[model samples]
Target: MAYFDQMGCKKRKRGERVFKFKTFGEQGHPVEFKGSFRQNVKSLLAFGNLGNSLCGGLASWSFQLEVHRNPPEHILLFVVEEPIEVSLNRHCKHCLHVGWGNHMICNKKYHFLVSSKETVATCFGYYEGNCNESYSGTAGKFNLVEFQGHVMHGVFHSNGFGHLLCINGVEMGSDLAGYQIMEFWDRLCTGLQARKVSLTDNSRKRSMDLRLLYGVAYSEPWFGRWGYKFGRGSFGVTQQMYRKAIQAIQNIPLCLLAQQFGNSSHDIPSMFSRYQTLSGHFLITLRDLLRFMLELKACLPSENGSIDTYHSGVLVDTTCRWSPKRVEMATRVIVEALKKAEFRWVSRQEVRDAARAYIGDTGLLDFVLKSLGNHVVGNYLVHRCLNPVTKVLEYCLEDISNGFFPSQEGSVTNDSELRTRYKITRAQLLKDMFCLYSHFLQEQKSMMNTGIFATTSLASRVILNSKYLIKEYCGKLPSLIQVGLGENSDVYCTIRVSHDGEVDEGRRKVIVPHECFMLRNNTTFNELMLEAEKSFKEIYFGLRNFSIKSIANLNAEGTDLVFKVVKVGGELVFEGSAGENGLNDEDVLEGFRRDSVVDCPCGAKYDDGERMVSCDVCEVWQHTWCVGIPDAAEIPSIYVCGRCEKDILEFPSLP
Candidate 1:
């Protein structure tokens, strides 16, 4: 029957076709059996020469092949057998649920037949789904293999929530679901609400907390899939969480908000509540703002963003929410109010720039004149009085000075009041202020040609120039007038003019016949002149109308005597004088003099009333008739003196 079957002879009708194949080989020969006719044909083709090789003393092996049904042409086959892998990928719609059982239960792996397909299903006491029918299987089809425990490949699927809870390449159990992540976010928000911490608080601890929450929500996991659904996006979830938190914060009451924000414990709630109650009535009037400015309670708006506590006290927050331009306008309003009160302060920055401009590279005076034109620099002087420094004694002086507040303008109504208030007269203040500025400007003026930027003014330049000229003139002024009086009411004094050339021994002191200059307590020029004239008459008897010229010589130009006097130790002394207009009680006079005197070696003072002659040899004066010249025309410009002629051998030597 086998040989006939091999020859394709059908003696009896068979329900199914069968094919058998055998192969022979040498030592260690391979034996193969075909289970179907297709496999038998493949086996026959694989083993060549099956005709005599089966019995040719070769290694022979025989096996039976059977097939109950025909095989499909191109059957689907698995690269691996038994299909133990469980993929929880979204494409496969599979998920894993882990369950733990008691230690006493033996570990096992079970295979289930579902719709004639095999899949791995392990049982503890729990399962993920409640639908038992979806996974139901007959007991006879279950196969138990050795089990290690929960060691298998499959990840959780979040069901309706998509793959949000799924982490690719990570086999997590389905029990850790997306709902748990959402619950975590909710709890955080609730905690924030219960604590009532202000979101705007810049405190260190609050800032740290916010940063920590933000960091945890946005930080990506090392091994998880970066998905977009549900709680998978760390950043997205964090944003949603903060949005809900902000909503919660907004729902808080205004009173509660203040209470939480205020860092004080005493009466803050009451005080804040009062403000809240009257918030509708709080009015910002011009007068109120002006008062605040005058009181120095607020400063001008600054360019650098900084909150003003003064404004905050007035229920105006200077936070970044307000525009800078609006804040600046408000600041200017306060400044205008300050100006109304006559309170001004120098800005060092502008002052420095003006100073630099005044002290330029070439001409310091020119620079100062230019700087005076600057609007900010022009009004620097305030009645020529500025406080240089402050001290205890200084405050006392300031108070005393304030009492003597001079009339702002026009004539003073009450002389007594003016005198009492201002112990120092206006003239004195003006003189002192001029001197101060003069010294200040001189010191600040740079002499070096270096063109470093500096600031100065025109008033300063005039002061400096005048100061130098006055100093130079003072050094050469004649010492005619005496200063300080003796205990006696009358004191003896000598007056003299400045000598431009050599002085004669006889004329070193101009003999004033008035030895006594009456030192009256009052400083009056009329009294002094009378006293001088009386002395002159005493010296030259019967001489009438003798005039006292301050700067007069027979040949030099003449000017009137305008005296400059200084009192020292209760004595009045004449320093020097420029002219009437140059007179200042505090100013030291300069370049003043009496008439120049001419004297000859002949022991006689020369005057225009006297007949005088000069010797060409010695340049000396002589009486025209006394020198043996009978007539004035007989005097010679080249005449030789007797003494000089004898020395020159022009006459006989005296024995």
Candidate 2:
């Protein structure tokens, strides 16, 4: 009988089948059959031929098979490709022999043979006999082989098309199932170097390319599948993994194009240029800020020396203290000197010398000191007189020199109480004397150049101008007319012409002798003028005292004289005398009484019979009678009366 298979093909071929039979004998010898021949022997011979092919020729086939008494109710065929083969060797009697291809043989009887495709070497089925010693009688039909260090199992199957094997028994249709098998084979063949396989050696590489092409071709379905697995709802499960994968891909090198040719020098120059530009701009801005701060410091009011507790105390109780304006002026002078030395075009040493000379000149120093008691700059004024050299002693010398003095418009009330409280230093008094001499010279010059005066007026103007210039430039003035004057008194004189170029009738006249007296007076005039000039030089350069007696004896014959005397207390007493004889006691006494009534020493008021005593240090006045002193035979030349003497001793000198 012939059977029909599922593909509509006859399972047997008539008259073409052959059969061969064999029987086992002792020692595995072939034995002839004892049964008689049947009429259907060709069918039996065909079955025997099929069985022989299954046992021997099937060893080279890439398929696994199993024979059972009953066929399986359901059959599933799988296809696989195998690159390596395993077979049993029949040369050994007691042992199963294994070799590649058809060289394998076995001693024990086996009912089935298993084979697999070169690509699909893994298979699974049931076996009835142990064909090889290592194969159990009931083993699963599969080929197990070791390649490198990894073990690979293969299985084969028969489908309608042909026999196929499953590598590692993995289903080929499953996702990544093909990759799994190829990776296993790859690991076995190459070990770690398998990852470096190129297209030449790796069929998997071609497969991977085909898969990628297919994925792109069916992008919709693949993307749909991917989205279903890793959509927004599923992102929590794979976000970190996906991000890592992207980062790895980005870090991987795609080509070596950049290594061969890359331009970085172009960027380097630009980067450095930008950095230098920004750095230079920053430095310039910093310099400008420093300059601005320095200029600001210049504009602020500053003081010399740090403020100490004493300075703070004086500032707080300013009414009895020297005004801050004086201190500020001193500070300005110091600061200006420093600035000139530092910034002026002139040499520093030259600037320093000029500053010192300007400050040291008695006339200029006196003007600055006097301006301390008046507003000479800005909104501030010095309301109290300060001793520039002593620093501590101050005075309110408010007796304004009214007749022939440097004048400004404003008047300040004399603070008698303050004057009594403060005393001027000797240096300050000398400075004031120098300033006054300059003022007198200025007045005499104005008088002489007016030219409205006659011979006498001209003479007087010339005399006054000469005397004042001598005193100012050489630093002293002399007195010619004196019968009696205080020990500390020095006379300064200024003679002015009448507006009509004549001696005014209303003015007091000086008596003069006729004829011979005039000649003698001319001689006296020459001698006294010379002596006055000499005395100026002695006082200025030698620092000597200009005595009233020495100046009075300059002329022996009669001469007209006008005297303005500064008593020890800085008071001015004026007297005029034109004389053939020297001033009589009565004239001297009368002039003294008139000037002395208002405290001839300091222009301070005196109580009845309160004779003023003069300070030898500053030549200023205090009341002798009020100070509890009896009259002395003569006022001591070096006597600073008690109060001023005490003040001088107490006040410290400037550094």
TM-score of model number 1: 0.13
- lDDT string for model 2 (369-395, tens) is 444332212111223433566554342
lDDT (CA) for every model shown? 0.25, 0.25
In model 2, the runs with Cα more than 4 Å from the true position are: 1-238, 244-248, 251-655
Q: What TM-score does each of the candidates earn?
A: 0.13, 0.12
Would you give me the overall lDDT of model 2?
Answer: 0.25
Total clashing pairs for each candidate: 14, 37
Looking at model 1, which ten-residue stretch has the lowest summed lDDT? 97-106
